[model samples]
Target: MRAALPGARTRPSARARRERTAGLAFISPWIFGFLVFTAWPILYSGYLSLTDYDVLTDPSFVGLDNYERMVGDPQVRLALWNTLQYTLLQVPLYVLVALALALLLHQAGRASGFFRTAFFVPKMTPPVAVGVLLLLLFNGEYGLVNEALGAVGIDGPSWTTDPDWIRPGLALVSLWSVGAAVVILLAALQDVPVELYDAARVDGAGWWRRTRTVTIPMISGALFFVTVVNTIAAFQMFTEAYSAYFGAGNSTYSNDAALFYVIYLFREGFAELHMGYASALAWLLFVVIMLVTAVQLLVSRRLVYYEGEQR
Candidate 1:
């Protein structure tokens, strides 16, 4: 105590040095792979967006032209409309469904685990397989959906064929895979303080009032987070719509009902080999998403109630 033992500040601990070195060594592969595969392409895509690269002709530097074309393209208009529609409708519907399912599964019950697994099964199935199955289920003639409707003495509309219903049919397929969000919400619901419920009960708060005042405010952050994420996912939907209608670019709809934003961009980039234009469109989509996300963040600050703050 009199000498005040050297505070070990001068020594580099062997374990600390070894751990740092080992971590760098372990993640070197990932760093290298990211640089080669992901980072380079993203950088190059920004460069390519300013050129007219069609693979057949030499990439001529035409800055902003591809972007201009995308701005004026009618297909872009329809694609944006479809993308916005899917996002606005499906995200909210699935978010509400997930919340309701979470509440149901979180109740004082024994079969909750089984219900969770059942809900999650659809999410684990491959998207392509889901698309193929939806084709069979939503098929206009001799399909399971219409067959069941016929048995109930109600006529079913041509879901896949009707221009008005094709997008909704696709939405129905996407809505089936709300399992991940449901699971997340269920976990959040479980995290909510049980004492709050007890307090509410003591104050004579009924189920609806308790949910509205307690469950909703506490879970608002999770709900908003899920909405933003699902909105992004819905905006990027391509495989189901593409497989259902544009496997060969020969759909018979008078207006391209299934012409989703990413599908249109994919056709421009890979199918038509218009890499430059697709890059431009990709950048535009990125900007749009950024703006939307910023708005959500700003708006969420008003609605999303975090714990420990007085609502």
Candidate 2:
């Protein structure tokens, strides 16, 4: 070969080119699936949001009417308010419960593995099943939860029927699936240096003091991750609320309390066949989640601590 000129780029060798082609071929299926299933649907949904389609007819462009309708829609406002209340009630409670369980497991030492598995089994329960269980457990009169409360001479509210208590009941139900967060937090706890605890103890720090000053800051990254994940999940809550209150033959409960945003979206799209309107609702949810996550990330910079990160 002639000597290469300055700044001249060299072509890949035959072997390198073949390897590159093979790598692309190997990942082609995933790339195709993502494009068809994820990317296309997302783009199409954005387009659909600007149209009026009832699934039976071709879409007619409606500009921003669907979005505008949401501004004055009582059901949309109620659903959004319900979803917001549930999320606010659920996220902090869920995080605290998960953290408490993680701390307990951390102290369990030899029994941690068994307890971890037991706790995680609930997370594997289907959401529909969990919803059914929620009804049974919080039935107000004869439910096990009320029965337990009665043992201490306290009466429990009708969780499924009472509007005031419905969101709290849903929040309590959310705590049942805290196992994944517990596992994550436990892993983070394990990674925390023992020397930190020892140093704190040497400084006469009590358990709570050490946890507040040393433990929390060290595991702040994991705490932040758990909060963010749970926040998103809470905002998107659907199956459990739907199965519990919005399902066919379930008219006894107060639906307004459980009419979460996703449940309304599902009803609009599939039940009522307002596909375009549902698409608009879906896009609004996407924007809300993105904004909320951005806020969390911005706040986390001041809270979360990472190893080797400069103060």
Most lDDT-accurate candidate = 2
Q: Candidate 1, clashing residue pairs?
A: none
Which stretch of 10 consecutive residues in model 1 shows the poorest summed lDDT? Answer: 246-255
**Model 2: clashing residue pairs?**
none
Please write out the lDDT profile of model 2 over residues 61-121, one tens digit for every residue. Answer: 9999999999989999999999999999999999999999999999999999999999998
Per-candidate TM vs. native? 0.87, 0.93
**What TM-score would you give candidate 1 relative to the actual structure?**
0.87
C-alpha RMSD by candidate, in order: 3.8, 2.5
Point out where model 2 deviates above 4 Å. Answer: 1-23
